[model samples]
Target chain A: TQLLEQSPQFLSIQEGENLTVYCNSSSVFSSLQWYRQEPGEGPVLLVTVVTGGEVKKLKRLTFQFGDARKDSSLHITAAQPGDTGLYLCAAPSYNTDKLIFGTGTRLQVFP
Target chain B: SAVISQKPSRDICQRGTSLTIQCQVDSQVTMMFWYRQQPGQSLTLIATANQGSEATYESGFVIDKFPISRPNLTFSTLTVSNMSPEDSSIYLCSVSGTSAYNEQFFGPGTRLTVL
Candidate 1:
């Protein structure tokens, strides 16, 4: 099975703290995407990591893909209350155009 | 990227009732999908709705339980039939992005609560 296992299922951190969420799988993927979802809303795409060992940054969030293409990480620097949400990583299924999501991580940043 | 909207943002329904959620896209899309999300859980693909064709359901989902309609490229609907407490969830509609990567743009989602 192509499973994206995420670490630290739930996290609560103080404002301005740094945190990192990991997504790992036994199967390799050509690319992976990270999404954030708030209550009563669907997930919103955050970033897509394609190349192995590549890193992309968007303001306070940084994304990194593993060299083997089977893992990824999302790091948030100086997290604020607005950063609180459920974080999910997803990749294409083995032989379909559909996406398979990660286990998920719920983050809560307190001021 | 496409901007998507869903109708009846949230609803409370009785058991054995059905709820139809509407999704409208700002542009034409070839691929649209429905997903279900339980509280504090990940998304599960319910089915793939393509215009002018039947919806392809996922392993644990069935058309009779969650019927879908895609009469055109810019709109679709998902109906949850014979709702039970277990059927309460957040239903989301999404379209495949116009990128090489498997990117998808999602709607706000419909929250359903069955009592």
Candidate 2:
């Protein structure tokens, strides 16, 4: 089974602090995606990294895919209380289109 | 992007009972996916529903326990049968208009609390 492991399962940061969440895997993936989920709602897609060593930015959030395509990272600059939520990384199955999600990282930004 | 909605956003059900969650999409999609997420955990794919065909379940899931239906591209349902307390989790429905590596839109999850 291809598993994606995320570091720092829980994070509590003061507003305006910067943080980075890591997602690592041994198996290379064709693509990787990051999502943020709020309570009582489903996850919303943040970014998708398809190429090796690719980086995409969405306002304050920066997402990077490793050179080997086996790992990814999400960085938030000056995180606000609205940034607090569950972050998940997912890799799509090669044979089919099913997504295999990573161990999530929960972030709490205190105002 | 697609707008997906799920019925019964939250439900408290007794053990041994069953609950079926409905998913509706704004646009037609080729595939609809069902996923389960334990408290504070990530998502696990349960099955893939295709129009006019039997749903394909993942390795640890089965059709009997989680029967799925896809009458069309824009709608599907997933039923959790004979629920146990351990079955309490957030169930999500997702759809992708593009390939697997592309973006996917998810519905507001159904939070099932088995008592």
**Global lDDT scores for all candidate models:** 0.94, 0.92
Model 2: runs farther than 4 Å from truth?
Answer: none
Candidate 2's interface RMSD, please?
1.1
Give the clashing residue pairs of candidate 2, or none. none
Worst 10 residues of 1 chain A by lDDT: A92-101
Model 1: residue B75 alpha-carbon error in angstroms = 0.6
Residues B39-111 of candidate 2 have per-residue lDDT tens digits of 6778888998989999998889999999999998899999999999999999999998575475678999999
Error of 2 at B57 (Å): 0.9
Q: Write the per-residue lDDT of candidate 1 for residues B8-96, one digit (tens) a residue.
A: 89999999999999999999999999999997789999999999999999999999999999999999999999999998889999999
Against the true structure, candidate 2 reaches a TM-score of 0.96
Report the C-alpha lDDT of model 1 over A1-111, residue by residue, as the tens digit: 899999989999999999999999999999999999988788999999999999999999999999999999999999999999999999988778799999999999999
